[model samples]
Target: MSETLGRRGFLSAGIAAAISAQFAATHNEARAIEPIERNGQAKFKYSLAAYSYRGLLQGKAAELTMHDFVSDCARMGLEGTELTSYYFPADVTPEYLRDLKRHCFRLGLDVSGTAVGNDFGHADPQKLREQIEHVKHWVDNAAILGAPVIRIFAGHVPKGGSADDTHRQMVAAIDECC
Candidate 1:
């Protein structure tokens, strides 16, 4: 019994040591990718989409404002970001857009674009027009933030509706925004 216990303990210690060594190796590998700053320049550049971190934000793991999100992007070695309208405190204002641009500039991260959530496939002309206006509003905000692209979505096709009609409505909305 004593010999069996000693063998089991030795095996357990060996397994623990192997796991610890693997953990240390993995940690060191991650650290090797650490951002480097030389002559006020970073060695690597990447882009982050706000949607990528939505789980953290909505889960309350992190209370991140737009500015804070941009800073986080910089810290993660990202040089660009795609801003989501949901993260903004309110309707995009010129002042707020300016501030966001400034914050990104200070952090050395560029606002690559804005993701505007607008569904413009409504059957009602009035509703479609409203959604178009919403898209244009975000496009304007994107322009203010020096974003080159504005991501837009085509709303779902309603059941029992003509596919042609839905396509026409989407085209009209696109024209209106343009």
Candidate 2:
């Protein structure tokens, strides 16, 4: 169980729960999101961003872990979760990743994906390459987690840099990562 979840986290989780309850009330006949059938009608599944629960995950309420995040999502009847990369241990290991995936599976939740903040808009070529490598690393991590999507941020233009040049650098960096 979550430890009080702090006042803010508790309030936020309660609000999310209330919204989920309202949605469930409206879709009383909704089918469980797992075991998708190709021939069945398309339906959207909800996922919560781990960033939304940063307070519980990493703030003073740091007793919370990613497993708790997944459990909370399941309790809300969510189909998936977005495990943002910033919250992972500094020295994340393959065992840790596999455990997370297993936990999500046990809870009938999908990892959905992870996210990374990047600066492909770096003015310097070296810095841009570093950003690209960073993205690639997360790409590998996401693959291990069986996450189908990874939301990444393309940083804003650097000071004194033209928008066009920054766009070019960002595009090139993305190309390299791809």
Candidate 3:
């Protein structure tokens, strides 16, 4: 009876030890899964859209230039920036675009993309053509700025227009832009 009691105690101790080891291993794994900056396994890059600072970026009273915006993004440890077209000076030249690209590169940031406000669902042929031209203009600007993408919006249905017509027009406008 003594021998049997000893064997039962040993088995219980082994089982408990095994469970304890497993729990410890699992706990470490959980800690490992907490997001680690610059970890090779991390698949995401962070960027800020310039449109986020629209209030500070728009109108005659606006304070921040695109360069200032980029500096802020760098300070915030962002990897990239999306330069919204609206904030650009009306007289933006190719040299300006190139200089912006240089500034971004010097600060260790990529011009991830650009955005232009466009309404592809315009019911009028002239309006839709204008929207397509607006998008194309941004595409040209993005290329000069070393940006890889342009964000565009498909517009709301124009008054008295059916959803189907708006969708079709949007698709056609997108095709034109392409």
Candidate 4:
């Protein structure tokens, strides 16, 4: 009888240990799967938008150049600025990009990103391909400028095209660009 009692106690202990181990493992996995909130208040480096100088960029009223924009960003205590592609010359060379990057670095500013207008929702396949190519070109330019991101836009859907088709086409175009 005593032996029977000892065996019963040992078996019960072993079962309890196994159950506890499983519970611990499950608890850790549950914690690991907890959703992350990315929209909460988080400190980020301040950046300026070169698009704000549209008038200057277009040579309308002010003649503030891209270099001047970078200098102004530095003077205003900004960490970086978006270099909009619209303001750039059509004949941008590799040397020009390198020099601009160096100038920004010298001024303690970063080329945060570059923005280019893209219309991926066009019904015409040729137009869509052209837009995709345009985006791709800017992506390379952004890399050359040492910019970390390239902001792209999908224009409004064409009159005859369905929203779903347009969305799918945009996704495919972006995939090709990437």
Local distance difference test, per candidate?
A: 0.84, 0.87, 0.91, 0.89
Question: Residue by residue across 20-130, what tens digits does model 3's lDDT show?
Answer: 999999999987865557736746889999999999999998999999999999999999999999999988899999999999999999999999898987777898888
Model 4, residue 54: what's the lDDT? Answer: 88
lDDT of model number 1: 0.84
Q: For each candidate, what TM-score against the reference?
A: 0.70, 0.73, 0.75, 0.75
Q: Which residue runs of candidate 2 sit more than 4 Å off their true CA positions? A: 1-42, 59-61
Better candidate by lDDT, 1 or 4: 4
- Deviation in angstroms for 79 in model 1? 1.3
1-178 in candidate 4: lDDT tens per residue?
9999999999999999999999999999987866688887887899988999888777645588788888899999999999998888777887888888999999999899999988899998898889988899899999999999999997778998899989999888889989
lDDT at position 158, candidate 1: 76
lDDT of each residue in 1-178, candidate 2, tens digit only: 3666687798999999999999998787575466656887779999999999888777545867888888999999999999998878868888999999999999999888899978888877788888899899999999999999988887889899899988887787888877
The TM-score that candidate 1 achieves is 0.70
What shift in Å separates residue 154 of candidate 4 from its native position after superposition?
A: 1.9
Off by over 4 Å in 4: 1-43, 59-62
lDDT of 2: 0.87
- Which of candidates 2 and 3 is the stronger one according to TM-score? 3
* Per-residue C-alpha lDDT of model 1 across residues 1-178, encoded as one tens digit per residue: 9999999999999999999999999999987875665776546647888988786554445676778788899988888999987677655579988998999998888888889878877877788888888888888888899998888998878788888989888887888898
Cα TM-score of candidate 2: 0.73
- Scored by lDDT, the top model is 3
Mark the regions of model 3 whose C-alpha exceeds 4 Å error after superposition.
1-39
**Ranking of all predicted structures according to lDDT, beginning with the best and ending with the worst:** 3, 4, 2, 1
